[model samples]
Target chain A: MFLIKHEVQVLDAKLDKLHHDIMTHQENILILTAEWSYLNQPGRIESLARRHSDYRPTETKQIINIENLPYPKKTSLVRGRIDGD
Target chain B: MVIKFDGLKSQKSIQLDGSVNKAIEGGRNRLLVLSCVFCLAFVAAGVRLLDVSVLRGLQEPIDVVEPTKENLKIGRAEILDRNGILLATSLSVSSLYADPQEVMDINSTVEDLSTVLVNLEKEKLFKKLNQKKRFVWIKRGITPMQQAQINALGLPGLHFQKEDRRFYPQRNLSAHVVGFSGVDAAGLAGVEKQFDGRLRDGSEPMTLSIDIRIQHILREEIKKQIINFNAIGGAGVFIDVDTGEILGMVSLPDFDPNVLNSASADTKFNRATLGVYEMGSTFKIFNTALALEAGTATMESGYDATRPIRIARFTINDFHPQKRWLSVPEIFQYSSNIGSAKMALDFGPKAQKKFMKKLGFLDRLPVELPEKGKPMYPAPWKKISTITISYGHGIAISPLHLVSGVASVINGGIRWPVTILKKNSQSKMFGEQILSLQTSKDIRKMLRLVVENGTGKNAAAAGYMVGGKTGTADKQSPTGSYAKSSRLSSFVGAFPIHKPKYAVLVMVDEPKGNKKSFGYATGGWVAAPAVRQIIKRSAPLLGLLPVDEVSPQIRRLLEIKTPQQKRGNQLASF
Candidate 1:
């Protein structure tokens, strides 16, 4: 009975340590998420993109409706090309 | 004597034996009772252990864990823009505090802390540390590097408390909308104050309808115009007409929410929703829409603009006067005050007052911002008051009211209560319809005409089908007279007139005209071009495709006949 009580106490201590570890990790995750949000502000990203990349914000004239798109043209196929290898 | 002694001894021996037997029996009975008691206690304890481990294990563990002080410190939820970009958030910062009583070597402590927290004055630290009080805040919202350096000091009484500091990542870009929280993490202004309880619960992020990109565009455009026109201040608002969700609301001379306490009251004022003004000719949209909805006027109905009408010492005239009988469309296109007054008189005071009340002009605008303006208008409905109010003089209201009212006029006659929060897709879309479908259609045509052929030509964006009205009202001077040179030039516009989606209002306060604008500080000269630029830039971001202006459907809807034909039709009707 004494041995069993001692073992149970040991297990409880282990569980407590695990719980504390989980809490600490959760706090770390929260901090990381906040840092990520700060780094990903739109104005910062836009300025960075302007300096380092070819990408720019989309202009109104670049956008068009689907109805304005041209139809695809038909092309003739050669049947023997498949067995060329 | 020896025999008596022996007999006594025998008696004594017998008594001792009997006593021993009795003692043994009593011991046996006591042991049995004690054993039974031990067995029952063991059984009870075993049952309790089993109940706790197995029976109660099947159910949730009701562990009443006490919340620590750190856990009790409420963290505010983040505020995100429509695209999930962070506008406002709460970051956990270690605030430096001191238990002055526990502080040893006060001089050294103050010296050490002041070195790490450079912003804190040494003299102030010395005075604070010398205080008889138990606690004092040495500094708050310290950087992580400073916290680490202070921790390295390992000084007694000097401790760091984990605190949540509200952060506005976009800064002044969304100052008025995101608002600022107090030092205690309690919301104090704007959306922060409006949804304080929800934010305090630290639930999921609150997503607003504001798009950061659109907000940036509007602010940049307004700033440029404010500078170019030499205006003292300006405000602009962009709203989704269908959803009634505000996309971008910019009030310039805006302050950064991050440093809100030091910002001036004027800088913190939200002009878009709070500042009330006599919105001038923009109110004509309401007058015209009301007349059409009442069936008292038609598109071809003519109003006499042959001369300014004198009514109760006030001469109602037009800015660009047409000295002839102008048709209903002509009246709207020209923005003739005389014609609008006549239309209002024909509509009658009773109906006009009812319509104005329905449009939400008689009270403060129901918006999320705490700073709101109560509309000022004449108490009694007099004849001259009707005439002046028709031209947007006697009645004063916020730009938000005008935009939302105009949105109702063009958006299938439904008046959706304006909101800053994003609407969920599953929610209902239709608001109360205030006009018939035919009347709404006619109003849209008249607005389109104003942009295509009349005063709001500068507000037109090519391929966007922009339609709107211009309003230039003179500011009421402190001496209770209209200031001639000081004007509030505003342009209220919407795009894709056939299927309106967004409504924008741009108002430049006290704009002075330069030589390039021909010294005319009118709405067209000062505010309209800014609206055009805003539409042109923000259209693509909103996924709005610019349509061909000359398309058959669009052309047919926006087509207006010549003045001669309009007159001939009017003559025929007579």
Candidate 2:
């Protein structure tokens, strides 16, 4: 009985430590999520993209419908058969 | 001694021995009872301790004792755009407070705090620290750096309290929609105020119907126009015609929701839904649609537009006057106020009032914003009122009302209420059928005509099949007369006319005439081009495929017949 009581005491202490660790981790996660959102604001990203890279937003008129695309050339492919086959 | 004892002595000795025996027996009984009671108490205590530690432990552990109430106060749920982009959120921050009664050396504490919190006044902090009160706030929303610095100071009586501070991640991008909160984290305006109770009670993020990308595009275009025209202000709204979900609503001179306290009344004003104006010829869409719905007029019905009609104190005329007999379609295409009034007179006032009411022009728009404008119309229906209102002069309504009503007319007659919250695509649409399906088709045709060849030509986007009307109304002065120089130029339009999907409205307040636009600050020159730019920039982002405008179906729907065709047909008949 004495041994069992000692073991219980040790387990209770470990459980308490785990709970505290979990709470601390949760608080950290909350703070980080807020920081993530702040960093990912659309305006911030757009300005960054403009400054750092050559990429720009695609204009609607620039996008062509599939039907508007020219048909693939049969001669561009090996005339007799499919390449893989 | 026994041998010599008399009878009385022998009796006394025996009695004394018996009494001693009785005393010993009583003492023994009391000791036995005491031991049993002690043993029972020990057993009971052992059982209780075992039950608590072992038996109860067999059950699942209690959920992590949620952080204390202060740490768990997720102030209000975060607000996200339709694409789950964060617009408004609450960050848990540490607020610095002082227990004034426990504070020692108030001057030194104040100096240390003020040094760390540069925005705080040292005198005020000193005063707060010296108060007899138990607790006083030093700063409510301190940065983490400030919190750490204050902690390093380790000043007695100073403490940190965890609090939730509302943060707008997108800043002024969607300010008027995801409004700011007060010091106590209570919503004060916009969607924050609209869904205050739900936001406070739940921790899940509230998703709005706004798309951040579209919102940025619309605001950028509107801002550009406002600067180009040197206009006082501008507003724009884009609504999904089928579902009535407001994709983006932009009001210029918008303020950052994070710093709402310093925003002026003009900056906070939501012009799209809250600023009512005489919406000029846009009302003609309603007049023409109503005229068709009532069976009093057809596309070919002609009205005399030879001259302006003089009634009482008003002369009803058109900005682009066509002095001839104009067909119903011609009347709308030319925006002839004289012909529209004659049509309205033929349709009668009661029907017009009922149609306006059905279009939600006689009451406040039921959008989620706390700032909604009540429509202004003449109380008693008069003859001249009908004439002026036919061309959108006497009756005043918000831009939101015009867009929502136009959405109903073009979106197959269903009048869906405008919503700012993201709606489930699978959810059933909610609206009443206010116009016949046939009449709606006819109206769509007429609107397409305007965009194809008439006033709204500037608003046309290639392959988008933009159909809309242009409205240029004189701003009503404080003295109740129309100001000549101040024009409220606006354009309301829908795209992919055969199957309308989106309705957009752009209104510019007091735009100045510029040299590029031939010194004409009309809706066609100002607001129409803004709408065209918005649609062009937003369509690809919205994943709308550009259709073939030359296809027979689209061509037949949007084609405008020339007057030469009419003359040729007449000659052929002869």
Candidate 3:
């Protein structure tokens, strides 16, 4: 009886600590998500890309379906290794 | 037992008398009674102790439910985009308040707060702290860094209360959709107001259907056109035609929800869903579709456009009049007001009224926002009302009404209720089929032809098959007369029009003519190009695969043939 009561006491204390940790982690995650959204605002990123990088808005003409890519030419077949097939 | 009684000392000691015997008996009985009472109390106490420990333990279980989130009452809930980008969130921040009566050395405390906080009115603070009152707020929302500095000061009477401060990290990006909340963390506007109970009670974050990236693109494109044309203001919305999800919606002259008080009423007004306006010739899309669906008109049906129709001191003229007989497809292609009005007459007012009501045009927009506008139309269904409403006059509806209504027409004629929340992928959606499949297909072809060879040619984005209608309405002045000098130019379109996935609508209020547009402040000149830019840039991000424009399959879906074309009549190939 003494042993069981002592074990419950220890487990209750540990459960409380875990709860506190979970709360702290949730707060931290929220703060981090807020910062990420703030930094990645569309207008700010667009201006930054324009000034420091080669990225441009994708044009409609640039987009194509995956199936539209031509299949590999028959003449361009590689010289065979035993396992290359 | 050494029993000796006081009766032995009595006068009856001379001989053993009956009195002595009686006194002895009485004393013995009293001693026995006292002993019995003491024993009963001890026995009762023992039983009670046993019952509390052993019996109760078997009957009831110990409660060990671990309370996690309930321990801390810090914030309400968060709002995120469909992609899980946070749009609105609340953080637990310390609000500084002071008990004026407890404030020791007010001058020093004021000096300490003034330095730590920017834009702090020192005089106001000093006056407030000098009062005999118990509590007063120094500042409601303060940064954690400033809070740390105040804590370092270690001033007496200055206390902090933990409260959640609502933050719009996206700023003005989704102002009208996500809306704003009050200082008490209660929602006041937009999605915040719509789902206030869920946001307040539940801990899980709410996800909106709005894609924030597409929202930014739509806003930027609309703002550019509003500035370029020097228009008063504008609103735009894009709906997923298949799913009835609003992908991106923008209203210019929009306010940043962060600074609610500074924005004017005009800027705070959400023009997209809350402001109803005459949508001009865009209603012809409905007129033509209804005519086909009612079997009053066919694809090769003809209407005379030789001259303007005059009725009851009102003359309906086409903007680009052909002055010749036009087929049903040609009437839509040219946006003929006379022909559309004529078609509406043939169909009559009863079907038109029912169709409009079925399309949700007779009621307030059934959106989640509190700022929704009620559509305006003539209460008494008259012939003139039907005629004018055919060309989108004598009626007013919000831009969202047009977008969603057009969506139903194009997406196989089903009227799905629009929603702002991101739907779970597995949820089945069902809506009433309002028009026939053949009518929907025919309307799609006419819409494509408008962009291909008619007034909406400017709306064509490369590789993505575009289909649309252009609208230019005369702005009504305060005196209830049309102002010819001012115009409302708008364009509404769907992309990969053969099988549309999205519908984009843009409307510019009172745009002025510019040199590039050949001094024409029309829908083609002002609004169509903006829709073009939005559809082009956002298509790739939306996972739309562009197809070959001249492919045989694509041409077959959008091709139109008229009676004049079949007969090779002497007419312009429009």
Candidate 4:
């Protein structure tokens, strides 16, 4: 009986620790998500890229052909052999 | 016997009478009664003690029925653009406060708090701690690291109050649309107020039809025009013509909703939805559509516009008069005021009212924004009103109304009400039919011709088949006179015109001409180029391919016929 009560108390303590960890993790996720979105705002990214690199806005010519979309027209391979081949 | 004898001896010595012995006996009986009462009380106490101590059973634990509260927050749900970019989000933050009475050592407590919250001044903390009040706010919106440090200090009096604060990740990029919330997480304006109940439920995030990429392009173009032309203000909106889903809407002098308290009333005004103007020649689009739908005019019909008409102290004259007869298509292409007025008079006022009513010009715009303008039209509906209204005067409608009206006319005559929520492209569309399919096709041709050869050439954008109309109205003075110096110049159009998919509008208020424009502030010079720039940049992003104008299918689709009869023949070139 004593052993059973001790086991129950230990399990209760473990459950409380797990619940506390979950709550802490959820709060952390919320804060991190808000920060992630703030950092990923388009204007900030665009300005940073412009300052660091020579990038221009996309034009019609830059977009690939619609027919070849979802997969490019060609994939090349060197004429080398694998053991199975 | 010995006690009684002693009492008797004491009584005999004091009184020497039988009465003394009787008195002694009475006293003894009284003492005995008091002792019996005391003994009964003691016996009752002893029995209760034994009953409680020996008969009571083992103790049992009370059950806790309350569910965990960490997942249950009363915060507003997130708002995202159509592509899932977070526009507005609710974040849980910690607010530090102190109980002055609970502080064991005020100096030490203040010192400990200042270590974690570096920005807090020591003097202010001392003043707050010295106050007789029970509670005071130390700081609000503390970061997690600061919270952890404060917790590590294990201060007795300090506490953290958990609160939810709204954060606009996009900042001012989509301010006028996704509005701000107050400190208590109550929505205040725009879409926030429009869907307050759903947002307050906070079950899931809501998505708006606004595409941030297109919104950025549209705002940038309008901003550029406002700066380059030195305009007082500008407004622009672009929509999916078929679905009536607003892809992007921008009203310049917009506010940063994040810092909403700093935004003034002028900057917060959503001009695109609320500001109404007498939309000069653009109303001619409707007049032409009305004439064709009512059988009052045809493709080959001719109107004699050799001279301006003068009636009721008003002269109806074209801006660039040809002073000769023009075909139905010519009146539309040249945007002749005399020709449009004549065409309007043929159908009369009653028919025009019915037509306008069907096109939603008679009511407030049915958009989701609370800021809306009711159109101003002449209540009496006179012949003069009809004539002026035909050429886009004597009636004031919002820019949103004109854009959606153009959309309905171009989208095979289906009048879909403008919406800010995304309409599933695969869902079957049901809308009111305001015009015949034939009239719609004919108007599409006229719009394309305007871009190709007429006043809207600047609107040829990401596609060759862009179709549009331009409007330049003299702003009315307070004393009911036209002010020539101030004009409302605007351009509205659709791209991929043959199978029209998108409609856009750019309006510039009181733009002063610059060296680049050669001192002209008309729509052709001011607002049309902005439309072209916007559509050209945004079209590739929107997945609209550049149409090949010379292709046989394209040529056949946009080909216009010249009236063969001598009466309808074109004027000879110089």
- Mind giving the per-residue lDDT tens digits that candidate 4 earns over B154-203? 98988899998888887777888887778778888888888888898865
lDDT agreement of model 4 with the native: 0.84
For every model shown, what is its TM-score relative to the native structure?
A: 0.86, 0.88, 0.87, 0.79
Measured over all alpha carbons after superposition, the RMSD of each candidate to the real structure, in angstroms, is 5.4, 5.4, 5.2, 8.3
The TM-score measured for candidate 4 stands at 0.79
Count clashes in each candidate, considering only residues at least 3 apart in sequence or on different chains. 0, 0, 0, 0
Better of 1 and 3 by TM-score: 3
Task: Tell me the spans in candidate 2 whose CA falls farther than 4 Å from its real position.
Answer: A1-23, A75-85, B1-33, B36-73, B560-574
lDDT, each prediction: 0.85, 0.85, 0.88, 0.84
TM-score of chain A of each: 0.74, 0.81, 0.67, 0.69
Q: Note the residue pairs that clash in candidate 1.
A: none
**CAPRI quality level assigned to candidate 1 from its DockQ score:** acceptable
Per-residue CA lDDT of model 1 for B1-574, tens digit only, reads 4458769888877877899779889999999999999999999999998987778868865674644535633488889999888888877788989999999898888777778877768888888888999989988889889999999999999888988898887888899888889989998989999999999986578999999888988898889989998998999999998888999998998998888767999989888888999999889999999998888888878889999999877677678777898888888788889999999999888888899888889988777778788999888988888898888998989988999999999988889988898889786765888888778788888888778777788898988999998899989998978887999999999988988999999999999989878888888878899999999988877777889998998988866654643432221000
Chain A agreement with the truth for model 1, given as TM-score: 0.74
Least accurate stretch of 10 residues (summed lDDT) in model 1 chain B?
B565-574
Instruction: List residue ranges in candidate 3 displaced over 4 A.
Output: A1-15, A76-85, B1-61, B68-74, B425-428, B563-574
Report the backbone clash tally of model 2. 0
Writing each residue's lDDT as its tens digit, candidate 2 over B1-574 gives 4555578677877876899679879999999999899999999998998998789968966864645544544567879899988888777788988899888888888877777888778887777777789989888888889899999998999889988888887888898888778979899989999899989987778999999888988898888888888899999999998888999998988998877768999999999888898999998999999999998898868889999899998777778766778888777777788989998998888999999998889999878889899999998988788888989989988888999999999988889988998899576766989999988988888888777767888898887888899999999899988898999988998998878999899999999988878788888888999888888878877878888777998878755444422421111000
